[model samples]
Target: MHSDPSGSTDRIEKDIVINATRERVWSTLVTFFWVDEGNLGTIDPKAGDRFVAHSAKEGSFPITIEKADHPSLLSYRWASAQEGAEPGEGNSTLVEFTLTERQDGSTLLHVVESGFASLPSAMAERAVSDNTYGWEEQLDALKKSVEG
Candidate 1:
């Protein structure tokens, strides 16, 4: 977790070591976002690709791919304020996933979501708390999905 002195932005980060190859972990992440989430359409895994993630529980939010490095790093920005607003410094949060292959045929996956400070103080606090728990569950699910 990261916080600025001005409370303008906060970060939530979680990492997991998966007993699987980098390719497997990456594939699982793609599926988790595109399939299980049922929000992202056909992902091209390229920067500038625009997508939407919709869920009954989470609602719909627009996302823009910020960076894509095959089997290593993938990052996107999601609107955290308004549903259809463009993801940017003040209106959205950036989610980044980094995968590192280990010598033991496993991979370490790290996820960081930042930019909560742009939102209202109460909303930012709630999002941080909610996502803290959400990330934990999601990472556990990812580990199971990839390791099993």
Candidate 2:
């Protein structure tokens, strides 16, 4: 976990080694929501592409693609649990996925969710705890989705 210099935002990061190629991992990431198999609805994988992710637990939320570099990195900004909230510095967080290919044909998937401290204190703490657990489950699901 890392935080910005002002301590106004905390970053939660997790890494997992998946028994899949980088291409396969990248395809799984940009094409669909890993936590839920729903399509992202015509993602261009370019900056400024807007998409919605539907989760059984979290419902639907908007995401703005911040950066997309094929087979390496994809980042997006999404609102927190607030309903109908727009993604931005106060109400949203940045989610970034970085892929590294290994010599044994496995891919290391790194996920980071940041900007928690920008929310209210209670919300920020809860989000940090919730997202830490959420990412663990999501990463497990990702490994299963690609490996199985």
Candidate 3:
């Protein structure tokens, strides 16, 4: 978690090591928890693609891809505060996933989500707090899913 002196979170960063190859982790990640997994066959992600990430406990979030580089990096803009709204100029945050493969075939997965400071103060505070917890749980889930 990265925050300013006033304790407002403008960015969130987390990394975890998964006992799996980078390629395997990447495939699982790109397809993780979408309500509609139909189009995610092996999840060959690309820039400009749009999708919704759904969680039964958290509803749906609109996502627009910004970058995708093979099994290494994937980044997107997401409207997490305004659920179901399209991500755009002032309403979204950038979320990036970076993967590094180790010599032992394991993977180091790092995630960074930034741009919350651009949102309304209260909203930014809530979004940052909620997502701070969310990432911890999500990463644990990802590790379990991939390692299995």
Candidate 4:
């Protein structure tokens, strides 16, 4: 887990090794990250597709897919601050996930969420702090979901 709430480094990076093949890890990552249990609809992710991630506790957030490279990478832009607002250059952060296959068949999962520096200083700091913790929790769950 790495984050700088001082606005100098406006991104969060997390890496976890899952005891699973890249294919299985990729499947779990795509499914778990994109379609949460509370999500309202299904999505076959691809570049340019738009969707809303509905969280019962946090509310809905609009997301736009930037790139979806099968089994290796997926990147998206999300506006997390305002509920139901569309993702844009000024209001959104880019979230990217990269998967690498290890020689031992375990998968290395890396995630980075950036663009916080563009947001208001207070918002940027809070977002970085919040997401730093969020990613750690989320990745742990993902590892369990894939390994199980």
C-alpha lDDT values of all predictions: 0.77, 0.79, 0.84, 0.79
Report the lDDT tens digits of candidate 2 across residue range 67-131: 99998999998875564566877778899999999999999999999888677666677677778
Q: Estimate each model's TM-score.
A: 0.83, 0.86, 0.89, 0.88
Model 2 compared with the native: what TM-score?
Answer: 0.86
For candidate 4, the TM-score is 0.88
Query: Which pairs of residues clash in candidate 4, taking residues 3 or more apart in a chain or in different chains?
Result: none
Candidate 2 collision pairs = none
Q: For candidate 1, lDDT tens digit of each residue in 92-144?
A: 78889999999999999999998887666666777777778888988988798
lDDT of 3 by residue, 47-67 (tens): 998878776667778788899
lDDT of 4 by residue, 1-148 (tens): 3343563677789999999998888777666453355344334579998777777766778788999888899899987666678888667899999999999989899999988888777667777777788789888888877887
Query: Could you tell which candidate, 2 or 3, scores higher by lDDT?
Result: 3
Tell me model 1's lDDT, rounded to 2 decimals.
Answer: 0.77
Every model: Cα RMSD to truth: 3.3, 3.4, 3.2, 3.6
Q: Which residue pairs in candidate 3 have backbone atoms (N, alpha carbon, C) closer than 3 angstroms, thus clashing?
A: none
Residue 75, candidate 3: Cα error in Å is: 0.4
